[model samples]
Each structure stands twice: as C-alpha cells, then as structure tokens.
Target: MTMVENVRNGLLIGAGPRGEEGREPWFLDPREILRTVRLRWITVLLPVLLLLGLAAAWTHLNPPQYAASTQILIDPRGLQVVKDGLTPPDQASDASLLLVDSQLRVLTSDDVLGRVVDRFDLAQDPEFQGRETLLGALKGLVARLTGRTEPPADPRLAALRILRDRTGARRLERSFVLELGVTSEDRDKAARLARGVAETYLARDAATRSDTTRRAGEAIEGRLAELRDALRKAEDKAQGFRARHNLVGTRAQLVSEQQLTQLSDQLGAARAKALEAGARLRQIEGVLAGGPSDSVNEIVQNPTITALRGQLAGVERLRADAEETLGRRHPSYQAALVQEKAVRGTIQAEIRRIAAASRNDYQAALASARTLADTLERRKADALKVGDDFVQLRELERQVEASRAVYEAFLVRARELQEQQRLDTSASRIISPASPPEKRLGPPTPVVFAAALVAGLGLGLVGSLGLELLAGRVRSRRRLEGHLGRSGLDALPRAPRGVAGAGAFRASFGTARGDGSYEVALARLRHRLAAAAPGQRPLVVLVTAADDRTGKSVLARALALSAASDRERVILVDTDPKGLVTRDLGAAAPRDLPATLRERGTLGEALITLASGLQVLPRPSDLPRDLAGRLADALLRSDADLVVVDLGLVGGNVVTERLIADERIPVLLLAVSARRGRLAAVDRALKAIGAGRRPRIVVTDVGARD
Candidate 1:
C-alpha cells in the first residue's frame, strides 16, 4: 500500500521528448519462407506422411515381378554369300540408326509376338486373364453408375497386350547390340518368353529371305527363257539374211564395194582420155572454119613449118619490090602472087589432113568412155542390191547381240539368287541367351521406399505452397511489408511462451522473464518511431488497425510501456467507440470530450496512469470536429514525450477521418494476422481517407491466420 501510494504521488516526468523518422517499397526475404515452413511444420508434414503410407500400401499389395533379358546383335550389313555391285553397300551413317530402329520394330512386330504367345500358351495363363484390381474396381463402379457394361477383353488380345506391356527393347549406346527384356510373375516364364521372341524373330527373318530369293529365282528363270527364245529368233533371222545377201564377211563391208572401187578407177582413166581427144577435135574444127589452128602433122615437123613460112615471106617481099619498080602489069608481081597462093594451098592441105585424123581419134575416145560408163552403171546397180541385203542382216545381228547380253545378265543374276537362298541368314543374332532370374527385377524395397519418400516430400511442399497461395494471407513480416507497399516498423510474435497474456503489457516487461521477446520487439518499435520523426519532440503517433480484433489496443499499450521504460514520458489515448482499450486499462470513460475541447479543459484531469507507469486517456463519447488539431496541441503541450493514439480500426467514420487528416502527425498502422480481405479493407479505407502515402505499418501475431 505504501509503494502504490508513493507511485500515485509521483507526477509524470518527461526525460526527453522523442520523435519518429523515415523509409523502398517492400522486398521478399527467403528467410521468411523458411520461417513460415518452420512455424507451420504440422501443416506441411501431415500430407507427406499420408502419401508415403499410401505408397507403401500400394507396393505391398502388388506382386513382385521378375525380369529376364537377352541380347541381340543388330549388324547394319546383312550376311550375304555373294556381294554384287547391283546391291548398294551398307555405309556407316545416320541411316544406321534407322536400320537399328527398324530392327527394334521387327522385334516387337505381331508376327514375332504372335508366335511367342502361341508357343507359350499365354492366353490360358491366369496372369494374362482379366481379374479384379483396384483400378478395375473403380472403372467398374464408374461404368455401373453410367449405366454401361463393358465386355471382357479377348484372350488372344489380352495375351498380346500383356506380352507387349512386359517386353522392352533398348539399343546399346555406341554399339550394334540390342537388349530385349521381358517381365513376368514367374521367373522361368519371363526367361522363356524372351528366348522365344528372339528365336521367332530369327526364324521369321530367315524365312523372309528364303521366300524372297525363291520368288526372284522364279522370275529370273521365266525371263531367261524368254531371252533365250529371242536370241534364237534373232540369230535365225540374221542367218537367213546372210544366206540371201551373201554378206559372209564378219567386217561391216560388202564384196560389191571392192568392184565399185575398181570400176571407179577405170572410169576415171577413160574420162581423162576423152578430155584429151575432145581438145584435139576442137583444134581441127577451128582450122576448118578458117578461124585459127594449133595442130601438128607427122609430115610437117616443127622445123618444116618454120621453113615454109620463111619461104612465103621471101616471095611476098619480092612481089612488093617488083610492084614498086615496074608498072601494074609487071611480070614479077604476077609471079609473086601465084607463088604466095600456092604456098597457102599447100599449108591448108596439110592442116586439113591433120584435122581429119584428129576427128577420128576424138570419136574413138568418146566411144570407149561411153562403154566404160555403161559398165560402171551396171556395177553400181548390183552394189545397191547388196547394200539393201545388209540392212536386214545388220538389224538381226544387233537384236541377237542384245538378246545374248540380256540372257547372260539374267543367268548371272539367277546364279546369285540361288547362292543367296542357300546361304540366307537373319540380320540379327542372339548374343546373350536369357536365363531365369534369381531376384526380383523391379527396384529394391529400400530404393522404392526412398523414392516414395522424396516424392511425398515434394508433393507436400507443393500442396502447402498451393494452400498459402489460395488463402492469400500475409503470414510473415516480408509479406506484410509487401502488401503495405513499405517496410514494416516492427513485427510481434504470436503467443510466444513466457508472455503473460494477450494484452498484458506489464507482464511482458517484467524482469522475471529476463527481457521478454515481446518487450524487445516493442523497444524496436520505439526506436523506429524515434527514427521516423527525428528532431521533433513529443511526436503524436496515431495507432489504428484495418479491422477490429487486430489487437491494436494491446499494441498501443505495449508501445507506451516500452517508451516509458526507456525513461521517456509516454501517453496512450483510446479513441475507439468499442471501448476495447478503456476496458483493458481498467480506466473510467471520459465524458463530454466535445465540450471539454471547446472550453479547452485540462488534459491532466482526463489522463489515468497505469500500474506499469503507462499513462492512458480514455475515449470520449463526443469528440469535436477539430479533434486532430486539438489532440495535436494537447500532445505537444503535455509533459509526455510521445503520444500513442489508439483509433481502434481505421474506417470512413468521421472520428478516424479526423485523426488521419493531419500530415504532421505520424500514423502507426497495426496489421495483425491479416488475410487478403482485411488488407483489401485497409486499402479501401486509406483511399477513402485520401491519404497520399502509406503509414508506418507494424505487424503483430504473425502466422495467426484469420
């Protein structure tokens, strides 16, 4: 009682008036994600365990499977007894991959699998038969609901399907080997099936080659018979033509060609002789016509003609002399004329005889030439007949040669086909034979369990993240800051152990707890406030929430207690009409706040100090319209260094509007365990209030979703 009275008497002492300060927009911190998972570990781990359990149950109910494997060599080049140039060579290229793939297809073809099924009699086996299963039961239930009945799977089809499902083929990397595996409930059956598929493939391949060879041989034989007949006919026709034309020489020439050559030479000689004769005849004709002549006679040699001309000239000279010396009728002139005429007549007679002999020679030469030409013409006619005979002969010989060549080629092909058929082998061969397996072929129990565990963990993490996304709640300080568009001033833990109660500020600050976590957080809040409004003493921080139940009143009290503990005077004002703060502080409600404000009543009378030395102002029933200015003045003049105004929840109400209207007054927005809907309400309120900037937000009770 004495200590309580002493405390009551002590007036509020202001150590130093503290002010608040400044601030990006929000950013994500990965540590917050880890914190979220750590806090909600139960929510994340439950699904994981359930998934793992289901996986284990499923594996246990299914029968263990055994696999048997056999290896086959896929040689790109097939084994052939004869290598012909007609067949393209197998080269190492990307095309080899196509060959390997084709082999794989053949391995799984219906022919191979059908043979295996028939050999094993798998259709009668219970394993391949349709039976009740979890999936089958579900399908049946669905079918019944849909009013449809499904027929049973065919035995042969089911067997084929099972074989295909259980078998697998994979090519060995960088090699020509292929691995074929078959899985079955019975180990021996798996081995037998694998071996059977390989044997059937080889048999089918060999049979295909043999059948192809046989067909080719039959075709070759038929073509060879036709070619032989054609060759015989061509040879017979050629022989007949040769017999008729007598073109017996193997060389492409005829005997008539030689005769033509001899006749042609004879005709050339005759023609030359005739040309010489005609020239002589033309000289004779020219002399007879008295034009000019150049001919020689046997009687008048070249020297004789020259002598005669000399004599005639001498006589003419004498006549001219006599004519000059004597009169017109002189005897010497008359004798000269007679002598010249006689000389001229003698020369003419000789020339005329030569002309007659030339004519006889030309006629004889012409007759001989005509006879030679007629003989040549008769020989040409015979040669033309021979050439006509060779035409059919040459065509028949060409046909015979072509037919023989074709017959030879076919004969060679037919022999090669026979050789190929005799030595045919499959492109692939079994290299490793399958044997019954001793252990199960599927993944080991431990490995399967580990895989299931990993998958479960992944699914659980995805599910937890999905739920968080769906709820769209701010469960961490980082998220809160992001939603508010600015970093938060402080964060409070939800129900930390050793904290006395939800709103027990005194219990939170007790020394017995060795500086409570909540108390430390409050100290940080005070530090933030001082930094936000630096150099300004007696800062008024309006504390409000987006909605009721955000624990704003408790936060306000905590802040006040923290400020006072720092040796600074702090005032807590409750302006909520709900009376949350008033009931919590155990204070009497103030009456007629509007009248008190109009008259400028004493603020000291309205103040009540708590047990923790935290001063509180009860909310008034009636507040004046100039509440922000009045409150600001009161807080500024008061002995308190900091004023924490608790306006329960910010709304469009006139009271909240008045408090947030003042720009000088720093607002502290208390966000507690807020969902997307609550933040949406806060955003609306802020917009309606027309506040250009966001207030300093403080998140409390993190991870407590509402």
Candidate 2:
C-alpha cells in the first residue's frame, strides 16, 4: 500500500466522547494564586522592600515615647461611713461593670485632670504647653484669612487638653481595676503625670464624698427643723382639740366614759337595795296580819322584838293559869291577865314599828334607785355627745404621732450624716503607683522591621494579584483547559526570530528542520488529532481565531502541509474575503473562486497546487452573497482525505458562522497566550458557535516551560 493509504487507514480515527464540564470544587484555588504571585514576584517584591525601608527609617528617626501606668481598684461600696449614702452602691455583676466603667470615665474627667494639671504646675511647663496641631494651624490660618481674631488660649486649659490627650484610662477586663496610663517624651514627666492623675482622682473622690455628706447633712438638718415645727404644731392642735371636747381621762379612756361607768354601777346597787327593803317590809306586814313574825328574817333577828315575844309568852302562860285556877273574879288572876295583855300589846307595837322602818327603807331605796337611774341617763347623754369630739381628737393625735415619727427619723439621719461629714473616705484607692518605665513604649526596632516586611509583602502580593487579573492572560495549560472545559489542547511556542512570516509557516511541517519547540508542538497536535477522531474519513478541520493576526492562516497551512507530508491527500482552502492565506502561500489562479463557481467550473480549475502536493483554493476579493452555501458546495465536491479551511477571525462572516455551526466539522481555535482578553475572546467565539460544539484550542506564542 502507498504511504497515503497507510496514513489514511492508521491515523484517521473517529472522535471519542468528550468529557463533561466540571464545576470548580473550591471557591478559591490557592495554588493558582500562588502561581500568579510567583509569576509577578517583582511586582510583589518592590512594595515589600519599599515598605521595609520606610519602616526602618521611621524607627531610626523618631524619638521613643515613655509610658507609665498606675492601677486603682474601684470599689463603690468600700469605706462606707453610713448605711444610706448619696450614691447607692451596686452589687450586681452588670451594675458593678457599669460602675467601673463610670469610674474610668471619672478618672479621665476634667474634674480630676484639672486638679492634676494644677498640682504639677503643668500650665507653665513647656512639655505640657504643646505646639499647635495641624488642624489647629489650619484653623488659625482660616481665621487670619477671614480677618477674625481668636481669643488667647488659657494656659491651664491648654495644659488640661494636653494631659487629656496624652493620658488614657481603661478598666481591666471582668474586674474593677482601672489602669491610668500616661505617655510622654520625658520619662520622669510621664511618671509624675501618672502619679499626679492618680493622686488627684483620689483627692477628688474624697472631696466629692465629703461634700456630698456635708450637703446631705445640711439638707437633713433643714428637714429636721421643719419636721420639728410640724410636730409641735401637731401636738398643739391635738391638745387644743382635747381641751375643747373635754375628752379627758387617763391614757386609755375619756372622763365621760369613766363617769358613765360609775353611774351605772351605783344605779345597780341602789336597785338591789330597794328590792331587799321591799321584801323585808312585806314580810313584817304579813306577820302583823296573821302569819308568824318569826318568819320575817329582820324582825326575828331584832333583839327588842325577841325579848317582847318572850315576855308575852310568859304573861300569856300566867293568864292561862289564872283562867284555869280561879273560877270567879280573883285579884291575882286579873293582874296576870292585865300583864299578859300589856306584853302582847308591847310585842305588837314593836312589830308594827319594825314594819314601819321596813317601809321607810323601801321608800328610800326606791327613791335612791330612781335618782341614780336619772344620773346615769344624763352621763350616757354626755358620753354620746363626746363621741364625735373624741374621734376628731384621736385623728389629731394620730397626726401628731406621724409627725413625731418623721421628726425622729430625720433626726436619726441627720445625726448619722453629721458623723459622716467628719469622716474622709473615697470609693477607689491606688493599688499600684506609677513608676518610671525602663524601656520605651511600642515595639522594638527589629520587630518593627519584621512587621513592616510582612505588611509590605502582603500589600505587594495583593498588588500583584490585581495586576494579574487586570492583564487577563493565559499562563498555565491546566488553567486554559479548565477554562475551556476540554483537555488535550495544544500550546505552541513562539517561532524563532530568524524565521519570518512565511518561513515560520514552512518550518512548522516542512522537511527543513529548525527550532524544536514549534515543530514538536505541531507533531503533538497531529497526534492529538489522530487520537481525537479515529476511523473518520475525509475529516474536515476549520482553523479560526477570535481576532485577526493570531496566526490562524499559518496554523491552517501547517496542518495541511503536515498531512500532505504524511502522503495523505490534503487540501488547504481560504475562506477569508481578504485572501490572506492565499497571498501568504503565493497561490495564484487564473480565475476568482466565486466567478469560477458561478460558471460551474471544476474544483481543479480554481485550485493552486504547491510543491508539497498540497492543493489551495483561494477566496475572491469580494465575497459572494451566499458564501456559506458556496463554501458548503465546494467542501462537498472535494475528494481529499483531509480538508483544512482557514475561517479567519471567527464571527466575522456568516460563512464562518455556518461552518462553525456544523457539528461534523471540528474547529481549531488559535489563541495568543500573551494577549490580554485572549481567554474572554475565545469564550465569546465558543458561545457564538453554540454550547454543544467543543472546539480544540491551540495556544500560540507561549514562552519556555519550566
């Protein structure tokens, strides 16, 4: 078999399945960023060195600042002299934090710092009399321009401002310890200022406490006087009310109530006496009528009544004896009878007297009871009349008691405040006094330089990344392939300077050997093509670029020569209306391609053959209206094993668009690796060709690989 037939059978293969486009797994690729930094190391390093130098100079030229710090414990509840104070002490954690924060503010307040300034006599010192700042100078300049005069600054105020600017106060985290720090150029001044601030803060706090106590004591004293007057008035009113109502008695009861109670008792006693006397009188009367007088307890107990009864009994016995012994009228019996009769008469008279006495007693008792009842009734009326007055008097007395209570409370508070005014105490005390620092503030020189170096390197790295993004060039093969979503793409090195335009094309696949980079790249491309689509006869390859002057025509001619050198039937067609490839290959024809097509000429009549046995079909100067149709017809009529068409500057014409749209025809997109926007241009070309089409990319003018 011939070499052409061998190549056709061995090299031509059907296209394999394409890989699926993958999403970037990571948001940012550190390796790619590092590669970009490495590529532009000079851009990154310049800023780093510059910053390092600047830091070194700054550390050397600037004077060191000395700082001194004093620590004070803020305890609002400490050294309390009284139970109730002007400011209540807070014990909650959040409240304590807020209290400490407030103390920190107080430590830096003008009240404390102003005293500090006076104690140190900083108003006259040059250190405290600082120079005008830039902003102040600008203000002064503006005032002068506007013909306005500013008042002279007070030296004390200026010193206070300077002290406030140079000093700082902060509370330790999660604690009540406040640290007051002062910075100055002079070490001794720094220490003095720190100590002065602490001392002044303590003095101010003590003075505030003492003043608060004094003011509170004064206020309590005034309130106590008012309360005393009110108490006096309340007592006077209560006494006057008591006098008017006659509601007088012991502490417990009023006189009207006591009198009414005594009257009621007497009335009961009188009524009982009257009932007893009436019972005795009735008993005596019964004895006089018919019943036994002995049954009357009063009469029975009377000595005279008892003796009479005995005499009458003796006489009656004598009379009975006389009546029985003397039948007729005898002198002795008559005398006994007369005696008995006299005794009986005496007993009766005694009984009658007793009964009269009982009746008198009954009448006296009844009268007494009636008088007592009348007196009690009058007492009750007086008591009822006094009830309303008593209630009013009690209300007045309650007011007096309330006033007295208030007066007493104020008196106690006043006494406590009076005692507190004598005591000198503060809420915070200095735990650590300020001392002159051994070293300066801020970091050491070596540390500063190291930090500067790191900062400059970071800045430079950011700058380099920015420049890389702005340039937008393809630097890595993996990145190019990843961006295009295909593999097996080729990158060709820049041609040798010794070889010109046509010579560079000829050297790509001709027998004349030159640089190995371009030739080796071409060979790799051919192998990739053979692997890309195997068992495919008469393969159509379209060579194009995003923009003009990207060596697409040269690449197309090289591809054709490569296949022709392999003894394969190859044809190179120029579809560019400019006929750039035709002029470059020096292919001249007797007739233009469109005119020949219009006349129905044979493909050979318009074709130009090179010494390498590669046929060329050049484009006309003016493109035909149906360029895509004509190109399709020409491609159909061709009998070559491999047809290479140079569709110059993709998306420039409808013919190129139609050719790219055809899936059967594979596209070879030429890209300049060094050109900005090259990737974006290639992406635009791919999108125009449509998403289903996967074009083989060739990155040209690449530098030497590592």
Candidate 3:
C-alpha cells in the first residue's frame, strides 16, 4: 500500500475491532455520563452546603466580619537581583520564591497575632470568660446534648490564613501579567496591607541591590590598589633593562612585538595540535567502522585509545602555552613534564599508531621548533635559554604586571559603576502602582450565592430520594405473586367502607361479583386449573406455604369459590393454626390443622356451611405440635371434589414437614416476597419439608415504587 493508505489502514485498525465485534467506546452511553454528573453534583453540593452553613451560623451567632482588602501588583516574572548587571534567570526565581515564602511565614508568626490583638482591643468577648445565666445554661445544655462544637478560628490567624489561602499569584501564559489577589473581611485594611507589602518589598529590593554593589566595589578596590603598585615597579624594571642595554623601541612598540611573538609561537603549536587531532580522528573512525578482532589481553580497543589521545592533545596545548609564556622554569613549565609523562602512559596502548604515522609527525614538528629556537638564540646572543626555572620567574613577573594594569582599570570603573547602579533604579521601577481596589476579589457575591443555592437544591433532592430508597416496602401485586410462585387472585377489589371485607363468595374464582373487580383475574385462574386436569373429577389441589401472611388464606378461598362456581363440590378448609378457614366466618386464629384427622370428630365437625355451595371447616385453636399425626390422616381422606386449606406461617407458627406427613399430596407454597424478602429462609424450610413435599414458592409482594 501507498504511505497514506497504509497510515489510514493502521488508524482504522486501531480504532475498529480486532475481532468481529468491537469493544464499546469510552462515551457511547450518555446515560452513564448523566449518572456520573448526578453523583458529582451531590459531592459538590455537600462541600458548598458545609462551608456556607458554617459561615452563616458563624455570622448569626457572633458579630459581622469587618472586611478589608489590599491590592498589590506582583512581578509576574518574580525577578530579583543576584548581583548588579549579573541577575541570572534561575537565580531570580529562586530568590523571589524564597522571599515570598519567608514573608508568608512571617505573616503567620506570633508577632502578627500580637499586633492584631493589641490593635483590635478584643480582650472581652463573652466566650473568653464564660457567664452562665439560666437561658445560657439551658442553651449550653442543649448544645452539649446535640454534640455541637462550634468555636471560631482565631481572628488574627483567620485574617492571615484567609489571605494565605485565597491569595493567588498566577502568571498569565506567555506574558508578564501576574494576578496577586487577597481576600479579607476588612476591605480598607486588606487594601492598605497589600499596598504596604508591595512598597516594603520594592524598598527592600532597591536597598539590597545598592548594598551588594557597594560591597563588591570595595572588595575590588583593595585588590586594584595592590596591582597598581606592582604595575609601577614592573614598568620601572622594564625601562631600566632597556636603558642599560640601549634597546631601541617605544614602550608601546615593545609590547606589540611581544604579543606578536607569542602568537607566532602558538601558531606552530596549533598546527602540531591539528596533526594530532587528525591522527586520533582517523584511528577512532577506523575502530568505529570495524577493527580486526583481538584475542590477546594486551591488545587495546582502538576507540578507547583514540579517546585518550584527544585528552592528551588537550594537555599538550596547555603545556605549549605554559612553555611559550613562562620560560622553561615555572611550576606550570615543570608540571608540563609530569603531564606529558602521564600522556605517554595513556599513549602506550597506541604504540602501533605512533609507530606507523604520528611518531614521525611529532619528531618533525619538535625538531623544526627546536632548530628555529636555536636560530633565534644565535640571532640575539644575549637571549636566555628557556628552562623550567627561568620560565617560572618570567611568567610570574609578566602576570603580576598584566594583572596590575587590568586591576587598576577595574577599580576606577567599578567605583563609577556602583554609583550608577544605585541611581539606575528606574529600570526595575514598579510598572503598576498598588492602590486600594474598588472591589474585593472574593468570588462575585451573586455567583457564590447562586452556586451555594444550586448546591443546596441538589443536596435536598438526593437526601429525599435516599430516604425513600432505604424505606423499602411492598407496593405491587406482581412482586408478591412472583414470590409465591403462583398467580395470586387479585380477584377482590379493596373493600369499600362498611362493606363486607371478606367479599364472601364474590372474592372466589379470582373475581368480586358485587365489587366489579378482579373477578376477571379469578376467571383466568379457574381456566388454568381446568385446562391442566381436563375431565379429571378427582383432581387433587393442595394449597400450602413456607411462611405466614403469604396470601395462602386468600388463595384457598379464591380457588374454592372459582371451582364451586363451576359446579364442583368445593370444601374450603383451614389447615393453618394462625387462621380459621371460616374464622373470618368462624373468626379465630387456628391453634392446629394437623390433629383433625377423623372424618367424624371435633376436627371434622369444625366444618361450617357457607352460602355459596361450599362447606368451610374453620381451623380450631391448637398449637401445631398437637396436630401432626391427625393432619396426615385427614389429608388422606377422599371426600370432596376440591379441598383447599389455608396454610400456616412458614418457619413461623409451624414447621411444614411434620404437618405434611402424607407425601402423596402435591404441595403448592406461598411466598410474600419474590426478590427482596428473605428467600434463603424460605428455601431452607422447603428443603427441610423433603423432596416429596414439592412446595412451589409463589411471591406475594415486591416493588420498587411504593
């Protein structure tokens, strides 16, 4: 592919999926972003409310804050003098930060606090010495009961820390505009204080610079005077030598000749250096490209040797300069021998290169120079032979003379410059003078109030919603029915005032005839049961539950009434101790359901005839422990076309397994909550009832919105 196509394809691959399906992008769902915003809205609201509430309470309980502000211009560049005419960029920043940070420390010191207390004359606030009247005692008691600790921050520290905290010094991007802001309760004081700081800092800057320049001038002056005396003596000596020897030249001409001779000597040395550099460069290039492999330990890497050679050349240049200026006897002149000896050690590994090409170059250069020097000596017979001792003395005398001349000049100039520096303060002058600001730089009042108000509104909504969430209760029929694992009869409408709450026969078949209600639902439940067992007259419909109040009583009545409407002999029975099948008809909590096993006994006679072609035997009051065996016998009886029993509370009033001793009877259980109410407890009870008691759990109530 062409470059553009290749680049496009690569980007497409990166952006698109590696496999057939791509992962979702960062922000595909706006709803998730909305959710995040909502959460953050609460977080932001919390802090705003806390700060404003405390501030408001503080104002109401105590006195109003007398606000003051000061305005000052900060040098955005944070420039400070390190030395006159030598203020480095890095040094100025370091100095400015050090000064500002130090000043901030000073503002927080005990000194400032002592000043503020003395100025304000505030030694008699009531809190300072507690006075307890009856009301005050009561209020203090209430405050203690509620665990409220509301003491104000120290006013002096409060003032300083407010500036220290809110004070912003920010430099505008790519420009020299700095923002120096401070907020205080006292507007006039804040303004004056800021201006005072600005003025004091400027004065300090000027004074410090002036003193530094004066000190530097004095130090240089002393050295300059000594150098002046030495220069005079050097001049006298030079003149004496010239007069004694009858040397013919102006003083200026003699100096120029000396400089020319020095350059001429260096020129030859520089050429020798060039030759050395070239050889080293060639050796390095050869190694850098490729060198023959070596097995011997003595063999050196040529690149390493070449680097050492460059350093040796640098030493040679210094040696040449020392020899030319010093006569051969100076310490530097003597040290040249020692340095050359070290270079020779470093060069030992490069014996091959020196043997090949550079040995001849060095010999030719050195021999040519010595021969020229000998010729110069013959030309001037009185000229000294240059040795280390002679070189030392000559160079020392020359340096002292040169330094004397330069130092005298520097002394005169520095004195003049120091005076000029003291006066040249306008360059660093305050560009914008500090003045009392017309308005304080705290956040705009309306903006702050609006932010705080919005925050409160948001927080209030969250608190309301959170409370609603925590108070979970059942509200819908579907959730309850789902928990029961059966379609519950929403057959009966809510009872009208003064009407029969039982809805009598009307609540059966999942329908209320007079109520004009969920009889429609009862009709559906009837259809489902009949369809399941078509043409089966002896169909067994067992109704039971794991726990109480799971709509088991309501379900039994509704089913029986539905089947009875279809001309089936429906006998509504209350097998639970918590309720009587007829208890609303017979009207009492059942004490037992299991002990009534006989066809003709007290349990059997408990049957009450109802108006709607149904015989209802209400449960007698008996504890569950007295009825388990009888219940097994009673359940096995085959008399009624449909027998519906009101079950007891699951895991509450009765353990179900003991009651359901007859396993042949298939069980249907009721549950009050499908998803939310404790399911594990219901499940464990069902499991205890054994596999034969196949209790189907139906939910009764669970809903998010109640």
Candidate 3 lDDT over 563-595, as tens digits, reads 666556777766665664454664542323333
Check candidate 1 and list the clashing pairs: 20-529, 20-532, 20-533, 21-531, 21-532, 21-533, 22-532
Write down the TM-score of every candidate.
0.54, 0.56, 0.47
**lDDT score, candidate 2, position 244:** 75
- Which has the greatest TM-score? 2
Best by lDDT: 2
Better model by lDDT: candidate 1 vs candidate 2: 2
Across 321-412, the per-residue lDDT of candidate 1 in tens digits comes to 88888844988889888998988787777677767887788788888889889998999888787776777777777888889999999999
Enumerate clash totals for all models, in the order shown.
Answer: 7, 8, 54
Put the candidates in lDDT order, highest first. 2, 1, 3
lDDT of 2 at 243: 80
Question: What's the alpha carbon RMSD for model 2?
Answer: 11.7
lDDT of candidates 1 onward, in order: 0.70, 0.74, 0.50
Residue-level lDDT for 67 in candidate 2: 94
What value does the lDDT take at residue 501 in candidate 2?
Answer: 55
Q: Write the per-residue lDDT of candidate 2 for residues 198-248, one digit (tens) a residue.
A: 988888888887888888889888887789898999999888888876678
